[model samples]
Target: MEILFYIVPALMIALASCAVAAVIRRSLRISRAWNSGLTAEARCLRTYTTTSGGGDSSVRTTVHHVYAFTTRDGRGVRFEEQGGPGTTLEGDIVTVHYPADRPEHATARPPARGKLVAGTGCLLAFLGTFILFAVGFMVVTYAMFSAVGDFSQP
Candidate 1:
């Protein structure tokens, strides 16, 4: 029981550190990919619905899309990604960034909505970590003080 006082805070700190690193890594990846090329219009070739996580745990529907685009040098390229509702649809024209030297590598050009969502998630994780650690520290400190008792009176 008392051991939990130390263990829980350690776990909370570790979780926060790992989540922060992950968010940073993801941001770097997107930034590098976008800077790799110029924007090009891509047409969604096909879309399909996929179910993820079910059975009273977690469940959500995601749209899988395949897009085709022609590069500046007249090379046809295809890219696929999964997105939420209405994010991807058949025949929908979307702007994507791709390396001129490598049409095979392409990504949606800085989707504002996705960035907002990711930022919000990272913020929440950090906030939760702080709250958890503060509460745990208070509980442990209170327990230790109470155990020591008032020594001023001798």
Candidate 2:
């Protein structure tokens, strides 16, 4: 029963680390997709105002929208633009890149801050998991060894 205390925590930490790694991998994949130019006729839509919160005193926030046209095998392919904040407005054409093989795989040029935010999040998650695992390991080892000494005494 006592062994479970150590094993469970270690397993949890390992799982958390794997989850963070998966996020990092996905981000990299998206970066590559954007660079490959898979989408067509990509254009930045006009900014729209959206209401946030409830009540008359609710704050109005500006959201930038973008549109992209994708085609496959010389045929028109249906694609939708997504993402919010820091996106380019309508009539303002932004650079759109995606993989040639996968026209649907695309993304707008993300702002520097966006990249920074994602990178920071991933770093923190990784570091946090590592620290938790290390501390747990040390604590478990110390407790186990101390128990051994206690048992030998009487």
Candidate 3:
């Protein structure tokens, strides 16, 4: 019983860690999907006028024009692209990484390596939690039965 008190808490912690890790992995996958189908060809830096919502405010700001060169199974595909805030602009020529099996599906930026790492880590965490729970349950059950046996002994 005393041992079970300790094991139960450890099991709960491991399970909670596994849940958080899973959420992180899912977010990574979404980001990878959005980036995978983009390619870069050229960039144009110029000042453009920006407008706010219903407010009477308009501003001029410098923006970069990004052109992407996409290829689908050896066929060329072209698209005009732009960089969002906080994203690095690697000049006119940008490397696009795509799935070899599906060339049409590509990204301007390489897929994140952390996603794979996080996924593996989460899986391991879940496995560890289950193992701890199983072992603790077995130990507690055995101790309970042993106590019963001792009480009945003549």
lDDT of 1 by residue, 25-136 (tens): 6565555557775778999889998887888779978777788988877788998766634666788898887766666667765655477557857776776768677677
lDDT, model 2: 0.61
- TM-score (C-alpha) between model 2 and the true structure: 0.51
Badly placed stretches (over 4 Å) of model 3 are: 1-71, 74-98, 101-110, 149-154
Best by lDDT: 1
For 1-154, candidate 2 gives per-residue lDDT tens digits of 4556567767777776777777676576567765554545665545565656668576766554646554555744334453454535566665555667665656565535477557858786776868687667869776887777644355
Model 2: lDDT of residue 89? 58
Top TM-score prediction, candidate number: 1
Candidate 3 vs. true structure, TM-score: 0.29
Superior candidate under TM-score, 1 versus 2: 1
The global Cα lDDT (0 to 1) of model 1 is 0.72
lDDT, model 3, position 135:
66
Clashing residue pairs in candidate 1, if any?
none
Note the Cα lDDT for every prediction shown.
Answer: 0.72, 0.61, 0.52
All candidates' TM-scores? 0.54, 0.51, 0.29
